[model samples]
Target: MGTGTDTPHGARAHARAQHGTRTATMPVVPATDWPDPPCAAGHLVWAETVAGGGYTHRPVARGTEIRLTDLQGDACAHLLLHSQARPWERLNVADTVKVQWNAYLRTGRLLLSDQGRVLATLVADTTDGRHDTLCGTSTLVRNTRRYGDGAAHSATPAGRELLTLAALKNGLDARDLPPSLSFFQGVEVRSGDHGDGDGDGTLHFTGSAGPGGSVTLRAEQDLTVLIANVPHPLDPRPAYTSTPLEVLAWRAAPTRPGDPLWDATPEGHRAFLNTAELLAAKDPS
Candidate 1:
């Protein structure tokens, strides 16, 4: 009897020929058109691209392992988050800045924030110190004419404008809405001190209603109201008005089981969960 490691060369060769020559079959699973599982917290999900460039849903919490098989390919996704009635403050673009230096001590890198916070640390890279801020994907625009009535529009109105508008429609009086509305353009209202911290001001949005309805909006910090008078042209119906702030608040406000919209299909609720799970697994701390 010969020990496995002490077998004769010819015997070893024979064994290798018999065992190594055999090929194994890999199981093939067909792709399904179902949404991915949801994240653990139920706040995030994942989406995979389906036929026709559309996305199929998945939850991030499913613990799926995703790999970028094609090293040369790029992954593009949009991210939106809110925290305490404001945009999430953690994610910042300036954290990836690279600084360059001379050969002896080539590059220097530093992450920056608009308010001078460090969002990330550049551990290593081929490029020299100091990355291009203009070229980076993380960019924040505080005030741009593009967001104005003419050139651009946000799917959801927020920030100072929304705050001011909410105040006005809630009957805070133009005088009370002034401070918050002054910086914005195309807003009109009275000016006075209502003694409501920074003086309440009104913010307004003017535009012809689209297929949905009218387009006038007013808001204050805690309240927001939208007024649209454009009836469906064909129906010749009376102008309709809506206070989206109330709806948004209801959707975002604290409640049992949270807002259903957070889990709704069209909102890509599952995809967000997947993203969160992926991020957690990556442990990009």
Candidate 2:
């Protein structure tokens, strides 16, 4: 009497037994117990090229310390900062030094901003005594012409472009930047008498844009004016394509010590020179 009726229940029990045999719960291992392998040397996902430049996405968060080393003696490295994914803003060398000095003198420690922001701190300086903000980053063309733009040239991504791309990725409009933003190629700055009458020297911005209406920018100011290449607040389509067939030329040769490029109008050069000197004087041991 039970043979046929109990057969279904027996099959179900057998299926359950098979499933339990195949499935076994295992304990999870703690992350600390299993550490990841060390990264390979020079296996950097992010690196700045001299020709292209470099930039940071977020503000050097409060308490962050950046150590700048003059890889090559007398070589100048340009640094820019941004807050909340806004435009890249130049850090006043003097402001940076004051912060550094106050920190060292008061606490025998490095400085920090009111917002807990710590700009770059010169941990070591084997090269030049100071870095120049006025003398911005060099471009691809500048390196090519100076070092023979051959395959052997070591190219770096432009910092300005990196900043622009970072902003765009974070949802900023490229066209909003003021005309002073210069990138990829250079533009000519004419006296106000000419139709191009902005007191600011010609601005050049180099980078790409997408059909989705985003832009990347790498810009430079002409003549080292205070207002040169400053990002403007407004939205407008960019002047150049995201990528072009031919490379643009530099408006002037890259800045080098004692070069005409550094000899921008006496007043402009003086402002930058003074700032550089102040920064050097405030250097903490």
Candidate 3:
């Protein structure tokens, strides 16, 4: 394990060197140049903030690269992606972890669907590669137990409300909302007698993002995205204050032969090939 100061565990450059795949936080897009947004180059697609429990929904197409910036340090964006073509083909959290053989996600990891298709790739993460997919969105009961009066309509809304509202906008009743990816959140899994009585061990969510630190993902397929900047359930913070986060989407160029995500892993390569073939069959040009 590299020292926290010099190299973090699974640092992007290290991931690339060891795995023959690129992994490093992508550069931050200058907010100065695109202050008015939608950029002078016409790339910015969508931007919004959900205060703690607020929610927003977006639909973006393939080859669209979106950058997620942490305007403040304590932001935790609970994200879910569904297929624009087939909403049923949403982000399958379990498949992503099991197939990739990783519990934590960072730049260079591919988000996989339950149907064995590539949904998106984590291109850059400035938050020390600490995103979580297991802990999932925070809940009312858990929040109420941990911090009194946790409700969507309450002064401090719950994280689950974000997913519920976003799912509703997607035209589904959301009887089964899948687990979500918690960006800008870090969770360390430990095995021992946690004393919680569940015998499931314990998860300690640590670390926080710095202002302007960001993550980026290049869409491998057209995606129906739902977002909310809610705190992680394991967040040790006293209040439900959510840091403001930003999203910037630009028209992504075509993927080249040497794309990092395409070569990140054996499974990643296979998934990319499958994606390319599918997209090509859909449009030969």
Candidate 4:
């Protein structure tokens, strides 16, 4: 019933309204914008913060250092890795634990792929080596039971669902998803044979590394890294509580022949060799 003109009012009125809306829509930039500074000056390549219960995925080049920081200590950064060149060759948690002869991850440990190649190396850690590869990310059913709702857009989304979204964005699907590693949360193996005189151990969810804890890993191969910041499956808290996670990546040199981690173990040494062979054969740069 009104005029079909581009502006119902005059051009001046529309300009004034648009200016007011833009001013209100824009956020104010403060001096203390960055909570944490870069690890190294002038070398930061990428930085992002994944809100609690959020998911993110990115392709990282070889020789890059990726650091995941638990900004408030309650964040469980569920992580999955895939080789960029060969997506089929993804992280194998069981192989990583078996090949290293240690279940607990720490600095100098290597994250191995299913094809017996090194995907990433733990070059730095501030969380007392607290990490888990056994207990995978949270599921929709589990989160629904724990927090009432687990839809992708729900208040409490499951890590699996969130990661599925991330995977789909990267040209992958649910079938490509495997078990993931969780950083900032500690799961210990305790002897369940108390007074039973048996040799058995069970997983115990200890908790996260207090606030400000972080871990850094160096990519050994070009990797597609997927992360979901959510509550750990075994977290005992009754409330659905999680904190934000900060991710920072920078340019760095990959491991070389004289690097300590490369020769830290004969098994790891062989894994590094396998990684090098693949890179050399594929790129040879």
- Using TM-score, give the best candidate's number: 4
Write down the TM-score of every candidate. Answer: 0.19, 0.28, 0.79, 0.86
**Deviation of model 4 at 82, angstroms:** 0.6
Q: Write the per-residue lDDT of candidate 1 for residues 40-89, one digit (tens) a residue.
A: 33322122221110111111111122210101111111111111122222
For residues 154-227, write the lDDT of model 2, one tens digit per residue.
33333334444545654554442222222212223333554446546543322122211111111211111111
lDDT of 3 by residue, 1-285 (tens): 663436666475565565532222221334234445643465666655445456667789887777777777777888888888888888988989998998888778888888787888887787887678788888878878877866767766677876787788888646647888888878867666667653465677765756777888878899888887778888777877676777777777645569765686888787778778877898899
RMSD (Å) of each candidate, 1 decimal:
25.8, 19.8, 15.0, 5.3
Off by over 4 Å in 3: 1-40, 191-201, 254-256
CA shift at 131, candidate 4, in angstroms?
A: 1.3
* Candidate 2 runs further than 4 Å off: 1-59, 70-76, 85-124, 128-130, 139-159, 170-285
Superposed on all Cα atoms, model 4 deviates from the true structure by an RMSD in Å of 5.3
Q: How does candidate 1 fare on TM-score?
A: 0.19
**Clashes by residue pair, model 4:** none
lDDT of 3: 0.74
